[model samples]
Target: MNLLAQTTNRVPWQRLTTAYGRGTDIPRLMETGQYEEIANLIEHQSTLWQATPWALLILLRELAKQKPDKVSSKEVQLYLAVASAITVDHMDSQDTVGTMNELLDEKYLWPEDEDEDELLWEEEEPPGYAKEAFFSYYYFSYLLLKDAIPIYTAIMNGNDKLAPAIRELLLLLEPEGVSE
Candidate 1:
């Protein structure tokens, strides 16, 4: 199944807008690589709609299609940076946390093994579900990059709440030499 298609199909195309104008008009903007419009309109202060990530994802896809040579991983890094900044601000609200929790569960990607019979201190086998969930936040999202931002912030700023998982996200984006 095409995940991007699945997500975009659910969008209320008429309701979403960007810096250049409505998201429906993205195709027009993409002809010229409306990069600025995407950067400006995709974000709403520190909040991002589910459409936001989808928009950037679309932009990346379009860029690849139009001129694959012009596309760069920087686009991915920059988009995440912007979304990550806003996600930090949104993290202050319980609503974001609640939404995050619900999504994690719904996605069947929750990291923890909730069965009480499982010992809390037990050392489980390698590569458990938590390992998978750690990676999921980097790839999946219907709520924009909200789930990614705070976890990234936590990893970057050492928030500790989602430290291990967020650290996993950071590793995906981190430069090889930056470890020093």
Candidate 2:
């Protein structure tokens, strides 16, 4: 079974925040493989959102399911975009990771959305949970992306152009004191 199918219903996408607003549109966008739209909503301005991890996970899983020769260039481009988004230096800082881990221990206070038709918060200022949501989203996405190094290797093995970049991205994800 597809990981997307497994979590699509379980994750309260409507309640989760994205770069745009709510992640309510993620599933629909994903169904059509709209990589550009998905990337924009999940990681606008290089900031990862609450929906980023799920979107990345599903994309990786979908890539893993396909034969290397059968994978489309668009899909590979999306993979490259995701790798760049997660491995950016600032996002991997010790301070940021520590804060994300600390927040992970506390129960998340999801923002309430009384009206599904209306926006969750004003564009000028997001709700308080916004920061917490970013931390949580980034943390989980980092972990998920780190674990996906093997998948990255497998996908890029024979591809001369992308393999080196994937290796560099994977190096960034490696834990301290460990080298591979």
Candidate 3:
């Protein structure tokens, strides 16, 4: 399926939670290209939601289509910067993988064992769904955005005007070298 179709159909958006509440409004916002609102919904006070990474995946895919240029609006640039900042904030400290393992050990959500789509779309969500969502925030955000490193690198190399925002983004994408 195409990216657009995946954006609309890949996940149970409503069963997901955002900063404010359920992500039922997310699909409509995405369809309308309401990115600023989307940013706000995904991250708030530097806290990421279950919907953050999914929404961000779609947003970055759209951004990847654009050629880097000086003409992109401040709102677009700001949103990119904010998204990168919040994502890195988690990457720097959160032990998402470990926490997720613990959640699984506790029988929180069986994303690893069950079909994720089926688990996400269940008529009644599992009891630990909300907590799992909370703990998985950083994990999914890091996992999804890590794949967009090349896209961010290309945009950064193509346009100097976006350097600051793109630099912040790369901090998340480009791994730091460790001293032996």
**TM-score per candidate, in order?**
0.38, 0.66, 0.61
lDDT of 2 by residue, 4-56 (tens): 33343355567566777778898898788887788788877656776677777
Residue 94 alpha-carbon offset, candidate 1, angstroms: 10
Any idea how many clashes model 3 has? 0
Q: How many residue pairs clash in each candidate?
A: 2, 0, 0
The sequence of per-residue lDDT tens digits that candidate 3 reaches over residues 63-125 is 778777732544355345344544333544343444322422334333433346545556475
Best by lDDT: 2
Better of 1 and 3 by TM-score: 3
| Candidate 3 Cα misplacement greater than 4 A, ranges | 1-9, 70-133, 172-180
Error of 3 at 40 (Å): 0.9
**All predictions: root-mean-square deviation over Cα?**
16.3, 6.0, 8.4
lDDT per residue for candidate 1 within 1-180, as digits (tens), equals 233333343433333323333456555654665556555555545344333544655554443343323443344444544444342223233323233233224333212333532352254621212434322222343233433344245334533443444454454343341222
**Candidate 3 vs. truth: CA RMSD?**
8.4
Candidate order by decreasing lDDT: 2, 3, 1
**Which residue window of length 10 is worst by lDDT in model 2?**
100-109
Error of 3 at 112 (Å): 23
Name every residue pair that clashes in candidate 1.
18-41, 19-41
